[model samples]
Target chain A: MADTSSPPALHFTGHRHLVERLVLSTLTGRPIRVTKIRSSSVTDPGLAPYEVSFLRLLEAVTNGSQIEFSYTGTALAYRPGLITGSAAGHGASIDGVLRHEIPASCTRGVSYFLLPLCLLAPFSKSPVNVLFTGPGVITSATPTGDVSVDTVRTAILPIYEQFGIMNKLEIRTTQRSNPGPGGKGGTGEVQLIFGHQVRLPKTVHLLNPGRVKSIRGVAYATGVSGANNARMIEAARGVLNPFVPDTRIFSENTAAGFVPAPERNNAAAKRKMGVGFGLSLVAETSTGVRFSADVAVPVEGGVPPEDIGRKCAFQLLEAVEKGGCVDVVAAFTALTLMAMGSEDVGRIQIGRDVLGSEDIVQLARDFKTFGLSGWGLRDAGEGSEDIIVSIVGRGVGNVGRKVA
Target chain B: MPSLAPLGKRKRPTEAPKSAPATKPAPGTKAAEPESDGDSDLQAIFKRAFEAKFAPLPFAPAADEGNHESAEEEDEDEDEWTGFDSESESESESVPAPVVVVHSTPSRALEIDKSELKAFLSSKPPTAAKPTPFPSSGPKPTPAEDEDSAANLKNDVALQRLLSESHLLSADRTSGALDPTGKNRHKALDLRLQALGAKGSLFKQEKMPMAHRKGIVRKGAERETKRRKEAKEAGIVLEVAQKAKGKSVGRRERAVDAPAVGRFRGGTLVLNSRDVASIEGPKFKSKGKGKRRR
Candidate 1:
């Protein structure tokens, strides 16, 4: 038995103070509208007002805690989208005889020729700092030019992958004159624009250098005449899109109905062949959030009970990944028919008996309320009890099933 | 011994001068002799004067004869009062007794007159003074007085009984005794009364039965026992829960992916959207173009 001594009541008084402090700091940094604020009895009153509110929200959503809120105005929920980009720049300088003579030449050829020469030139004995500024700041500087873009897309990659989002990449370059007077006038700029987008088989890591190397030849240039600048930006944006996918997928699968008796059986045996089908449902609530659920039922004599169970389990797993609701009642009804014997016609056991009258009524109500238009179901084989059912909704839906 | 010498030559005759009685008498020797003579003469004079002053003078012959006649008449009066003179010799012997008798009769006569005066005063009226009885030579004992003594003795006995009862009661209260040896019923009764008085004050006019007091005490004991048991059970459960929670928290900590901001010792960089756009566009373009030109 669970030792249920009285747990101390949560005093929210302490959280009030903490919430105030947190809200003050957040407001000081940036103005934000407080759409809803709730204080839970379980929260410590010492918590800052903002922190307490945030924690209370977290508890309410995750722990099934009831929450009450006084909202001042409508709160805008943030819709997360894919974010993608690349860290790119160059760092080098020419000095002494080569630096002096390169700019002295009048022809563009000489200037262009000097580029490769600088690339091939021996390392300078004198060290000079080369600062590269771009879309992402260089958090740290090393002699070797390496940069990192630490943003939300990169931070939430794992969460995105769990939802089955994919990432793709692209790169591009541009040309411009060096700002310094040393150049003849025109200079070539190799702008490596990294682009990414969601793709299938979400397990793939977009930030992997190997993936970047594979996509090197694909310039990913969209149609734009003489618009080198626009091309570069598009290429970078494209690379970043695949880095974070904004799409969400939800799906579920289940089996329904009973099997028929042997051919030689009497009228009672013929009655055993019940109507049941497999069902699968998938729905996407948001670009990156999906909900799915599934249920499967066995057909007597047509399919093995183990097979039916495995199919049902697989349907549920698929639904879970989809992150949506399922029509549990219909799925259970179908499963019960499949489990019925030919001799047991007109008998259904739900919650310890053949589908109880109340259970049937509840099943119908559940179906009517949560059933989506695009739900799917499929039977395993002709005269076989094997069936799959799937349904999807905004989020995880009602989960109910008869043990029998 | 009187060796006189000049002051200057005193030293020369110093031994001789000192021999002037090697000890000349003390300075007041001559004056002391005269004072001693005067003291002896004064003492002799005082003795003579004291003798002359205390000597009694001789009586006159006539006064002696008068006193003799008064003595003879007193003898005659005595002889007359004696009515019987037995033998002459017996009479002579009884003569002295008659003189005593004669003198006593006069005194008797004076006492009779005083008695008569007292009688006359006493007989005068109803307002006569009652003779006051003389104080008894020793303390007069009364039955009431004896009763008082008896009461005192009883009080001592009562006091001793009370003291013993108190000692026993205190011991009983501390030792939790309902009844001790039954030798002294009175002591027991007293103890019981004291206990009742103490218990009575705690309640209103309605006396609390002994059984009810026991019931209340027993109930309190039962409640204490139950509370202790509950506390022990709660403590064990809390300990287990705490340990389980700690393990779970440790696992969660291991699973957490530390934010990149954690490495930002100086401060995390918060680049504005404009800054990011500039760097990604013109900055990249500038670097690329410069490379191409070179």
Candidate 2:
């Protein structure tokens, strides 16, 4: 498969949108070469630890994937491979689950790796089963703008149901953690099982985002008092009950996770990490669309649970006030599936502010670079600020699933 | 207890003059009798009884006029009252004046449903729609609907019987009615038994002689062949003839109490090659020689 006749690699620069580029390259079976990744920075002028860890995860799930880095780690050349997900003898353990570990020095949340991996799971040849356990798995929201794992399960996963891939999808978190001191690492465990594989995602035309019918939430306190969860639930209800009376928040309190903090002489010393509380709110509309908000205490730990809960509630209100069928957090996943669907026009309504965000606009440019057609946009014509985006699918879906 | 009596009398005369001049004489007369322990004792007893049934009263000069009349009538009874009762009455009156009622409400403890907790907090994502609980017993059906349902059930059974019995009527259609007393009625009854899963026809002769059975089978085959030949000569298409099924060659199961090997007869057991082979069980096949090996 590594012959000279392979297509020329697409070129990209800068470290921004690196995950999106790699995901597109894998789905399209094309090779990518990214240069000048954090090249201007003096102390860290290359791909970060989390990025390298993500590349390592990509290699574990796929077969024949090649990754090459320069001396300074600025330039990278990645050749695509077949997504043989969790198949026996392909870096998967005896139970047919690929275990990916994040380093203790990594700062990003676990959702950073989970979101893109989910996009590739449905197109893989076999079912994707991955268990994420390590010291760096932060289950809560981080200061770097990543959502908590609860939002990923309650809000983002339900979006795949509309695309005809709903069976056997589950996300189990045996342990919960917030970011450790200095927002570096946490000890957490999470497992993702995506058993539904389809050749093409069904085209969707979702325009009407109905009124919010109910609201559900989770208030998690790790290594902290259970009263913090009660306080957060009360504060969040104070803001959300008047708008939607069917609000329920479940409380979860677990002991603080401990990691090995051994010194030169003491080999058995362990310190507690991820001691904080957070709230995750998901507002589901009558049409089954979901909008989510997350707020967690910083690692320095001065914020009260009331502030975190109120902030999360107001953030959920803002997400709903944006007025679209898809939330800004889930827009990328929805749009990517539409672009990879069968050869037909799939239309979805998105808020103007959501579409104007940096991540979604860059996603459009990346799709164009991959040789896909441009999107067609028009006003939703409901006296609102929503824009209906119509995308044409690539018709080349699930290259690994073609044999089946 | 007696120390506050003078103070009570002094304030009463001062407030009484403000309401009316008519009441001034009453309070002035009460003040003159301030040394009378009997009058103060009766007032203390009345105050305790009132406070027990209702709220404690503040200083009311108007009620003193009514109590003065009752005081004269109960003067004899007050003398018989014990000294311990008067002391306890004074103590009760002192506490109500300085008492404070603190209204403390307990915090509400929301009881989370166990089923709901299992549904939402489990590993799987929560289902989109909540399950609506079904009513244990539905409302009683109206009399009109009940009668209509019963009538429909009766018609359904009648229609089912007609569908199965209509073939019997078609065989003798010239009469245009049911033949209740003819051979066709017996045939219809046999068909009903077969429909109910009977093993075989009751009219079949199970113990006929072998020669008689062979002759009957030959006659039936000859009649079927004759009809097919005439139809072919007349150039009329006929239905295909069905082949007779061969007898099964499998062994019959023996009774449980019988011997496992050859049959026992005349006080001696008879053994055959087939029976001996059954006792020895199956032999293994040799791949090289294409033969069986024990």
**Candidate 2 chain A, which ten residues in sequence have the lowest lDDT sum?**
A237-246
DockQ for each candidate?
Answer: 0.00, 0.18
C-alpha root-mean-square deviation, each candidate: 62.4, 18.6
lDDT of 2 by residue, A1-404 (tens): 55689789999999999998999999888899999999999999899989999999999888888999998999999998888889977888988999999998789988998899989999999999999988999999999898999999988888898898898988999889999988998998999999999999999998988889888899999999999999888888877877887788899999988999998899999999988999999999988889999999888889989789888989999999997988888998999999999999999999999999898999999999988769999999969889999999999899888977
Docking band of candidate 1: incorrect
- For each candidate in the order shown, give its overall lDDT on alpha carbons: 0.27, 0.83
> B30-77, model 1: which lDDT tens digit per residue?
122233355544644554455478642121112223334434544554
**Which digits, one per residue and each the tens of the lDDT, describe model 1 over residues A1-404?**
01224222222222112222222212111111233232333343222332332433222111112233334212212111111111122112332111111221221221122111111111112111212122111111111211111111121121223323222211111221111122112122222111122211122111111111000001111111223322322322232224222211111111111222336546445211112222222222222222222222222224432233234334333433322111222223122222211221121111212123344344333333322122234443343332333222222111111110
Q: What's model 2's lDDT at B106?
A: 26
